[model samples]
Target: MSHEHRHQSHPRIVARLKRAEGHLNAVVAMIEAGRPCLDVAQQLQAVESAIRSAKQTLIHDHVDHCLDARNSEAEREELKAITRYL
Candidate 1:
């Protein structure tokens, strides 16, 4: 694949990831501050949800922008490999 591959969804995906990062940092702080376990767990779930959403969007963007009917077998394999992460 080309190193210069770009997708229209990339910017939004990045923003989502950055927000996830911030949430993850907050989760760590919550743990240190002795926050209630339920509160911490809920925040952790939110962080996980953010990251999962970003990953799904990124993978879909890749499939939309990078794959086609004429794609090679290797490309199809790559797609399958990425989907396994989900």
Candidate 2:
């Protein structure tokens, strides 16, 4: 896929990341405020999930658009790189 096509979902990905950032900030505040451990953990879990979702979105987009244009060897290398996220 062309650069333009590959970046089609960039805005969405950025939005997710921004949300995760905000969630992380909240987690920090929760810690400082002496919130319950359970509550802090829950917020941390949410932040982790948000980041994971963003990662999956990025990998999926790469597979759908960028990978199609790559050769077999390059695709294998790319897949290897993507696996680190898993």
Candidate 3:
């Protein structure tokens, strides 16, 4: 089977990443504004969580919609490559 990838969740994932980008910008502004370390750390954590969630969603979507069981060798390699980020 051909392993042409499809991303059904692209819009949602892009929105999520945009939110994370906004949060990251806020974190940078907070640091420049001399916000307390704890508050900055919390915002940074939120940004990290958002990015992680987006990544997992993308990876899961790829595995669900792209992987071909009949092509186990190639699919397994792709799975390993994608999962390394997690």
The most accurate candidate by TM-score is: 1
Range of the 10 consecutive residues with the lowest summed lDDT in candidate 3: 1-10
Candidate 1: tens digits of C-alpha lDDT, residues 2-81: 45767888899899999989999998999999999999999999999988898889888887765798988878888788
Q: Candidate 3 at residue 36, lDDT?
A: 100
- TM-score of every candidate: 0.85, 0.78, 0.82
What overall lDDT, based on C-alpha atoms, would model 3 receive against the true structure? 0.85
User: Which lDDT tens digits does candidate 2 get at residues 1-86?
Assistant: 22234467788999999999999999999999999999999999999999999988888877665455445775667667877876
RMSD of 2: 3.4
The per-candidate count of clashes, in order, stands at: 0, 0, 0
Instruction: Order the candidates by lDDT, highest first.
Output: 1, 3, 2
Q: Which ranges of candidate 3 are over 4 A from the true structure?
A: 1-4, 72-75
lDDT score for candidate 1 against the true structure: 0.86
Q: How high a TM-score does candidate 2 get?
A: 0.78
- Model 2 segments more than 4 A misplaced: 1-6, 69-76
The TM-score between candidate 3 and the true structure equals 0.82
